[model samples]
Target: MKLRIKEVIKEQGLTVQEVATRIGKSKQSLHGIIEKGNPTIGTLSDIAKAINVPIYRLYEDDNDLSDSPVIICPNCQTQIPIETSIKIKSYNHD
Candidate 1:
C-alpha cells in the first residue's frame, strides 16, 4: 500500500525535514519510509500526527479495487498485470 506521505507533505507544504523533526526522526529515515514503504507502526503514527491525518488514510481497502492497473518501471511502458503484481518489491525489480 502507498503511504500517501508525499501527497500529504505536498498538500501541507511541509518539507521532509520539517516533518521528520516534528516526528523525532531523521529526514533520511522519513524519506526511506515514504519511498521504501516500510515504516514501523510508531513511525507511521508519528507521520499521521505530523500530517494531521488518520492512520487509516495511509492504507487502501483491499476490497476497493481501482479499475486501472498500476505500472512501475515505465521504461518498458509495459502494462503490468495488476492481479499478478503482488508487491512493490516485484514492481521495483521489473
Candidate 2:
C-alpha cells in the first residue's frame, strides 16, 4: 500500500483538507499531486510554510543518506540508514 503523503500529514497532525486550504489547492488536486509524488516548487513551498518547516524538510529530515535504505526513528525523528548491503538486502519492511 502507498501512504507517503498520508504518513507526513499524520505526523504533522493535520488533515488533507487543512493542508490543501493552506496551500491554496483544491482537495482533489492536492490528492492527485500527493499520490503522484510530484509536487510543483510553489506547492512544496506552500506546504513547507503550512507545516512550519523548510522546503527540504517538507520531504525529508536532516539526514542525507543518499543511496541507503533509511528508516526514520519514530521516537527521535531521526533518519537511520541500514549501512551494510547484506543487512539492507535482508531487512523486511513489513
Which residue pairs in model 1 clash with each other? Answer: none
lDDT of 2 by residue, 46-76 (tens): 7768866544444543344344556544344
How many residue pairs clash (N, CA or C atoms closer than 3 angstroms) in each of the candidate models, in the order given?
0, 0
lDDT of 1 by residue, 7-74 (tens): 77777788999999999889998888888986777677788798886555554434332454443322
What TM value does model 2 have?
A: 0.55
Using all chains and alpha carbons, the TM-scores for the candidates as numbered come to 0.58, 0.55
Task: Find the candidate with the highest TM-score and give its number.
Answer: 1
- Indicate the TM-score of model 1: 0.58
Cα error, residue 75 of model 1, in Å, equals: 35
Error of 2 at 66 (Å): 13
Alpha carbon deviation, residue 17, candidate 1 (Å)? 0.9
Residue 56 in candidate 2, Cα distance off native in Å: 1.7
lDDT per model vs. reference: 0.67, 0.65
Off by over 4 Å in 1: 60-94
